[model samples]
Target: MAPRLLLVEDDLHSRTAITLFLGDAGYAVDPCPDFASALRHLQNAQNDVPDYAAVLTDYNLGHRDLTGLSVCQAMRRTSNRKAPIIASSSEMKYWEEVADVFKLNLVPKLRHQWDGPAILAKLEEIGIKP
Candidate 1:
C-alpha cells in the first residue's frame, strides 16, 4: 500500500497545495485543518497504533492554542517516537531548538522556495520518502 501521511495546515491554499503535492507524490494523505482534528485522526485510527508513515504539520494553525510542535509532542508522548514528524513554516528557525528537543524534522514553508525537492530532502533526512 502507498504510505499514509497526516497533513495538518490551517491555511486553505497551503493546505490544498500540500495535499495535492503529496498526493501526486503517491502518499495517501489524511488532511486536517487544526491540531485538535489532527490529533483525533491520529488517536482514532483503526489500529491501536496510527498507521501513518509520517506527519507534516504547519507551525501555525490560525490563532489556536496549539501548534505543530504540540502535535509532534503529543504524538511522541502517545504513539511512536520514531515516526517522522515534520514541521513546516517560514519562521521554522525560531522553533528549531524545540523541534530538535522533540526530534522532529524541520522544513521551510511550502509557499516560498520550499518545493517538492526541498520537502523530499527533509523527508529523506527523517528517513521517510515518497
Candidate 2:
C-alpha cells in the first residue's frame, strides 16, 4: 500500500502542485490549507493510531498566529509522534530554531529553486520511499 502523508499548505497553487506531485509519486496525501485543519487531522489520527507516515507543512500559513511550527508540535503529540515532519519555507533560516526545537527536518524553499525535488529528497531521507 502507498504510504499516507499529511500536507499542510495555505497557498492554493503550491498546495495543489505539491499534492499532485506527491500523489503522482504514489503517496496518499491528506492535504490541509491551514493549521486548524491540519490540527484537526492530527488530533483525529491520535485517536485512531495515526495512519500517516510523514507530514509536510509550509511555515507560513496565512496571517494566523499559528504556523507550521504549531502543526509540527501537534504532530509530535500524536500517536505517530515519531513520524517524520518536514517543514518548508522561503525564510527557512528564520525558522531554524523552531525546527530544531520540534525536531523537524527543514527543507529550505529558496527563491527560484524547485521545491518538489527538495521535498521528495527529504521524504526519501526520512525513509518514505514515495
Candidate 3:
C-alpha cells in the first residue's frame, strides 16, 4: 500500500503541487489548508486511530489563527502521536519557535532553494519508514 502523509499548507499553489508530486511518488497525501482543522484531525487520530506516515506542516498558515507550531506542540503532548512532523518555514527565526513546540526538524523555504529531495530523504533518515 502507498504510504500515507499529512500535508498542512495554506498556500493553494504549493499545496496542490506538493499533493500531486507526493501522490505521484507513491504516497497518500492528506492536505490540510490550515492548523485548526489539522489540529482537529490530529486529535481525532490520537483518540481513535491515525493513518499517516508523516506530517509536513507549513509554518505560516496565512492568518494568525492556525499556526503550525501549535499543531506540533499538540501532537507531542498527545498520548498516541503517530508520525514524524516536518516543519517548513520561510523564515529561519520561526524554526526555534516550532522546534520548541515539537522535536521535529525544520527546512528553510529559501526562494527556489527549498530542497524537497533533502527533506524527503531526511524524513526517511529520521525513521519515517514510508
lDDT for each residue of candidate 3 in 1-130, tens digit (9 for 90 to 100): 7777778888887888778867776677878888877877777766876556788888788878657876777666664375677778777677675575467777766562335676667667887644
- Residue pairs clashing in model 2 are none
Give the residue spans of candidate 2 off by over 4 A.
Answer: 110-114
Which candidate achieves the best TM-score against the true structure? 2
Which candidate leads in lDDT? 2
lDDT of 3: 0.72
Tell how far residue 91 is off in model 3, in angstroms: 0.6
Query: Model 2: C-alpha RMSD to truth?
Result: 1.9
lDDT-best of 1 and 3:
1
Give the worst 10-residue stretch by lDDT in candidate 2.
Answer: 108-117
Error of 1 at 99 (Å): 2.3
lDDT of each prediction vs. the true structure?
0.75, 0.82, 0.72
TM-score of each: 0.85, 0.90, 0.81
TM-score of 1: 0.85
Candidate 3: list runs displaced more than 4 Å: 47-49, 79-82, 97-101, 112-114
The predicted structure with the larger TM-score, 1 or 2, is 2
